[model samples]
Target: MFPYAAELIAYAAGAALLTAVGGRGLLLISGLGVAATLGVVGPLLARALRGAAAAPQPAPALT
Candidate 1:
């Protein structure tokens, strides 16, 4: 999946979850959403950072 898409999904999911949980204020909900988003996206980001940092390969020559 696309990295940015995954991050967006995570954030939306968090906000929805918080909404269901019934927070007292928008600030609190927003804060929790951020934490939740980070929790999910953090691993994906870490994995990418740990992976190879190689440059993109060039296209193959025509036969």
Candidate 2:
């Protein structure tokens, strides 16, 4: 939910800036979008992977 909010804010801000500045703002908006996405996704991915690694595995079946 927080990540989604961050994404929404970033997109809204980027869109606003792009609309106001046209082509010149694109690079900045693109950089911001990437940074925001990474900021949100990196931690989520790390946490998910950590959780998965920590979860218990099932025992193997007998041959």
Looking at model 2, the pairs that clash are none
Specify the highest-TM-score model's number.
2
Model 2 agreement with the true structure over 11-48: per-residue lDDT tens digits: 99878878888876788777888999999999999999
Error of 1 at 9 (Å): 17
Q: Which candidate's lDDT is highest?
A: 2
CA lDDT, every model vs. true structure = 0.81, 0.91
Question: What is the Cα root-mean-square deviation between model 1 and the actual structure?
Answer: 8.6
Q: What is the per-residue lDDT of model 1 for residues 1-63, given as tens digits with 9 covering 90 to 100? A: 699999999889868866776656656877888999999999999889767466576899999
TM-score to native of every candidate shown: 0.44, 0.61
| TM-score of model number 1 | 0.44
> For each candidate, how many residue pairs have backbone atoms clashing (under 3 Å)?
0, 0
Residue 63 in candidate 2 has what lDDT?
A: 100
Runs off by more than 4 Å, candidate 1: 1-24, 53-63
Clashing pairs in 1: none
